[model samples]
Target: MTQPRVAKDWYESAGVRSGPRRMLEEDREFGLEVFPERLVPHLAHEGLADLGAEGRRALLTQHFYQYMLFTSHLETKVVNRGAALVAHGEVDIEVGPEARLDAFKIYSDEAYHALFSLDVVQQVEKVTATPVLPYDFGPRMARLDRTVERFLPDHGALGHLLQVVAFETVVTRFLAQIPRDEKVFRVVREVVGDHVRDEVHHHAYFSRFFKELWAGLPPRTRSEVACSMPHFVNDCLRPDLGPVRAALLSVGVPADRAEEVIRDCYREEMLVAGVRDAGRHTLALCETVGAFDFPEAREQLQLLGLAD
Candidate 1:
């Protein structure tokens, strides 16, 4: 049995009481230039390509926009929605008052996270003056929704809940790295770090909740969710070269150089490093939830190099 976490402390630890409250001003310790290195393939970092400071900066800033956008999307759509279902018993999963209370707290946290992520984006825009990827705002979640519907037409919420559980269970590791990564800007570090603190607690919450949800679910529904979960995880972690390519072009990176960057950056080895590792937590959690117990799902995850 998975240990149940005290949900109330998570509410307190969301940093609403105290943490980076003011807008991030441009500062010397954390300049825009140094924010997280190696936006492209390791070749660029290894001096195989001359992307220049501006090119690298543009790449990182574009990546920052993606980071914030996804964060907001997750907090609002996935986490918040999951909590709402649990709190209101809209889904089949039954909830006690204590669990519902905790879910409400998470509901608040998710909303705040969504709001704060956009604020960080604005602060980043002030410093970098780069285009945040608003165009990407809809496609990712939409893709997941479409895929889930195709898989479980009658029970879309089951897939959504599974995906949310998968992502939240594993997202802590991804969020935790940002705060400690000295290469990123200080404010950005603080922003992600603060989020990480909450996610640590969230990881616990989702892990326990998913176990309960899975136990309550019917066998056929569980089987269906197991099959569909990997695709949702893929949707979350796979890096699209489209935005990267556009950002490079916007910054006057020659087309040939941009192609080279994309080619080298998205190589099979790099995909394992960036995409697989980014979603490792999700994969593991999915396995625990029996998502990978199905033969087809296991095969799919293995094909994507996500099978452990």
Candidate 2:
């Protein structure tokens, strides 16, 4: 592996280094939508779209709650753990002290993200009076587990690290749109805005880390792992339709209609485009590291329609 280098001016420029981010200030005027309708695709379904303003508002609020739910889980369960492993040298890579220190920063940032996500969840629950419906990480984790078993059965910590790399590097539209969208509530905008700022540095750190890690892997192992990249990219970008369906049902849409709405709104083409667009940076990073140097690796990604 190439010698790992510390990110440039991380302590001075990182959002976490400035001091703990201020907690989101609740807006007294809570009537503004907590999430933009454009961010939630299923809301565009004809039946769900016709639910009128108040109904749409409730669904948007619930979608925001689910967004926090995803953030909290991703920060605590996925990113933090991966960052902790790197910081402590528990992972397979041999990173420099500077790299480990940056991983510690990532770890700290993600934990703070989880706390604020839950805090917003509480504030929104009180303000909107929309009870958070049942949500679970089981199915998501299970799908990931199944994918790993199929593609990299003995991956162990490598699997975890790869998942972290995928999520950190893949910028999703939902995260990008929330802060600048004036239609979203002020508090929600502030919360996501804080997150987006931190992620900018985190993205750079992980991109460099992935290149270093790929340089360190054996050629055969590299080929095997590269085959799984498209799957991981899809996992990172695909919308969690389970929660969307539940939110729809809770908001009084019939179960049948909810399923139809999700299916219609998230067609195969739309999903492929979302995954490709969101994962473009990750794919380019892999290409930089020669992850697709082997014909088989390129073929695997092409089969997923992620590359030409």
Candidate 3:
């Protein structure tokens, strides 16, 4: 069994090294705005963009809330679940002590991340006086749940492991991109910047984990998991427009017009482009194990606009 290249000196280098983050009261007043306008691309729609300063701020705040909520849930529910499975030896994959120890560290980082993410969400709510709009576990996780349901009664754990593998191995662009825009609120950028630093090590750990997991699977099981890769990529990267539509309506756009705005901004081509750009790392990792070699998997990828 190939041992995953565990992150070195995690006690010194990990985000958890500093302990949990808190949103200082002054952070709310530090930036002119609460969230970056660029982070919410739907605002670029002429109809939506014209929503003036106040309207735009309302929308950006809601978008920011949804982002933090999404991050919190993903860390606690999905990533941590995967890490726990490996750390506790619940998974079938055989790994070295180094990998298991790193899994524990990953688990800690994810929990700390979730804590800080929720901290910001609550602080933003108090600062903006805008309660987070009601949402499910987030569209991406909801989609993953539905996909995992198909393998119920037997392969559920395998399905879940693959989903985590697909998600963790990717070099997530948003993690870095969110902090790059200095115009974004200082707190938002700082929190995400911390996450970005941790995920760099996570990306390396999971890449090696995937190689080990793939090497040990039987051919039939490999094909079964491979068949789901395209859909997994699609589920993971496709932008969820529900929150955008809600944010638009909250900003006083009429119901019908909000739908139109979402349709225009989140067009089919734009969705495909997002997946192509964000899913590249995951798709490439899958290809490393020939996940696309199966005709069924290849067809699925092509149909999802991930391939010709």
Scored by TM-score, the top model is 3
Q: Each candidate: how many clashes?
A: 0, 0, 0
Candidate 1 deviant stretches above 4 angstroms: 1-6, 20-22, 28-34, 39-51, 131-133, 172-175, 272-275, 289-291
- Please, what are the lDDT tens digits per residue for candidate 2 over residues 1-308? 23333347657765556645444445544556777878778777788756887778788888888878888888888788788889988877786787788788788888888888888888778867788886687777776666677777877678778888899999786678878877777777787888888888788878888877887888877887798877888887777788888888887899888888888988888988888999999999888888888788799788878894
Query: Over the stretch 1-308, how does candidate 3's per-residue lDDT look in tens digits?
Result: 34545457778777788645656466555656677667678778787656797787888889888888888888888988888888877776887787788888989999988989888988888878877887667567878877777533257777777777777765556658767776766777788889888888888888778778888888877777777877777887776787777778887898988888888878899889888888888888888889889887788788889984
The estimated TM-scores of all candidates read: 0.85, 0.91, 0.92
TM-score of 1: 0.85
Task: Estimate the lDDT of model 3.
Answer: 0.78
lDDT of 1 by residue, 139-226 (tens): 7778778868876889976777766776776553545676777766777777776777776776787778877877888888777777
lDDT values, one for every candidate: 0.70, 0.79, 0.78
Cα error, candidate 2, residue 201 (Å): 1.1
Lowest-scoring 10 consecutive residues by lDDT in candidate 3? 1-10
Please give the lDDT score at residue 260 for candidate 3: 83
State the local distance difference test value for candidate 2.
0.79
lDDT of 2 at 305: 81
What's model 2's lDDT at 111? 87
